[model samples]
Target: MKAFLLVGFGGLAGSMCRYATSLLFTRAQSDFAWGTWIANVLGCLLIGLIYGLSEKFQWLTPEWRLFLTTGFCGGYTTFSAFAFENLKLLESGNYWTFSIYSVTSFAIGLLAVAAGVFLTKM
Candidate 1:
């Protein structure tokens, strides 16, 4: 519960920050997907830091993991989360699940992007 709120609040903050950062960059950069990539990378680094710190300091609880890992990281990234989960599964020798998840995620992500682009043209 506590973790949930922390993650929720962090997500809200992260999302707002993502938008603001994009707006700022769009004014100056104007290259490609600066926003999405930035958010995803930042979220990934943050999650990694959180996990590393938790492991090092033993400061993470179930609630904290829920809040930081599931909540904040989730709000920031669905793609990275999928990759991380699949990687962990495969690393732990769950090859079948990893294979299924990897294929599904890649297929869905590609199809969804295609569909979104097609729809946007309409």
Candidate 2:
């Protein structure tokens, strides 16, 4: 319950940050979603930095880790979680699994979105 609360609070803040970013970086044209793209990239970078710092130093407590990584990053951009997981797989030398996971995740994720849209329309 406490962990959940921490995550929820962090998520709330992260969501607000994402919204603010979207407002600040409004795209002049619809060809690209700069706001979302920047959010994901920044989220990934932040999570990576936190992970690295935690690994190098034992400063961050479990609650802080949960709040920052799970709550904030999850809310900010789930792609960061995916990116971090992929990075871990690569670091651990699981090349084949990493390759498979990367390819299938993107390909099937796109397909899933298409399927969802089609199903919703029909």
Candidate 3:
């Protein structure tokens, strides 16, 4: 029950933050789904940091790990949105944009995670 509450609260906070980020990107008036991309990449980076710190420094308890990684990061990252956006782009015949978005999101997201873990070492 305690664990559930922690994760729930973390998810609530993460969801709200994600929404705010989306709104900020919406104001940019760009066709690309910058909000979703940034959110996912950031989420990955955060999770990496959390895991790395927890492992290296033994800083986070299991409960904290659950809250931050499973709850917060899971809520913040939007794989569904990514998939839907790709579908829309494909349907609209934006192959080039779709390719670039999909490829870069994957590549950069991985790099972001690596970078986060690397930062912990420094």
Per model, state how many residue pairs clash: 0, 0, 0
By the TM-score metric, which is better: model 1 or model 3? Answer: 1
lDDT of 2 by residue, 1-122 (tens): 99999999989989999999888887887778989999999999999999999989988999999999999988898899999999999999999999999999999999999999999998
**Cα lDDT for residue 6, candidate 2:** 94
After superposing candidate 2, which stretches have Cα over 4 Å from the reference? none
Question: What TM-score against the true fold does each predicted structure earn?
Answer: 0.72, 0.94, 0.61
Question: Given candidate 3, what's the lDDT at residue 97?
Answer: 100
For model 1, where is the 10-residue window of minimal lDDT? 21-30
lDDT of 2: 0.94
- Superposed on all Cα atoms, the candidates' RMSDs to the truth, in angstroms, are 3.0, 1.1, 15.9
Q: Tell me the lDDT of model 2 at 84.
A: 97
Best by lDDT: 2
Candidate 3 deviant stretches above 4 angstroms: 78-122
Put the candidates in TM-score order, highest first. 2, 1, 3
